[model samples]
Target: MNGPTILLVDEPTSALDHERGAAIIELITALTHERATATILVTHDRTHLTAADQIVEIHDGRLHLPAPAC
Candidate 1:
């Protein structure tokens, strides 16, 4: 759980109910901070976006990022 760890969790909350989902997310976030591990979470849920340090959205095999204003 520590020392150069990488956690690749896919749809971790997909099967959980709302309360459980939130709790799981909180636990994972806390573990990331406590263990200082690199966590890569993959999901289609936008609600978890705010918890991420960086957001990379992929659509139609392409990645999207915020574009500069004209």
Candidate 2:
């Protein structure tokens, strides 16, 4: 009733500077939890993994299922 509950973000900060990029990630994670929505963020930036409930990595052209957080 509020809005779309699922968010898919692919390289949402690809064109931004590091500071702005981090801010964007922070906003995204906050909104995801605040709205109780599912967010699928596909990015090469592994630093944002802490915000994810599950993480899948692509290795050798295959998707490796969610691995234990490092």
Candidate 3:
């Protein structure tokens, strides 16, 4: 794979089924870790965000970040 410092993915799994979507997420996660690449995943589906290191949401043209875990 080409060495990239960052990867931006937009709705990569939107057209896929649940299983395929999961596989894509896993692949992205693995690549992010293995390559030490920063990944930006934009998706409407909130089901698979567990793989993210940080999660943010945009609402009413505002950016909202979640509170850190206790």
Cα shift from native, residue 69, model 1 (Å): 11
Candidate 3's TM-score:
0.91
lDDT of 2 by residue, 1-70 (tens): 5677899999987888878888999999899999989998999877667767888888899988965658
Q: What stretches of model 3 exceed 4 Å from their correct place?
A: none
Evaluated against the true structure, the overall lDDT of model 2 is: 0.85
Native-structure RMSD, model 2: 2.6
What's the C-alpha lDDT at position 66 in model 2? 64
TM-score of each: 0.80, 0.78, 0.91
**What C-alpha lDDT do the candidate models reach, one value each?**
0.83, 0.85, 0.94
- Predicted structure 1, TM vs. truth: 0.80
In model 2, which residue pairs have backbone atoms overlapping below 3 Å?
Answer: none
Tens digit of per-residue lDDT, candidate 1, span 20-64:
988888888888888888899989877767778767778999989
Residue clash pairs of candidate 3: none
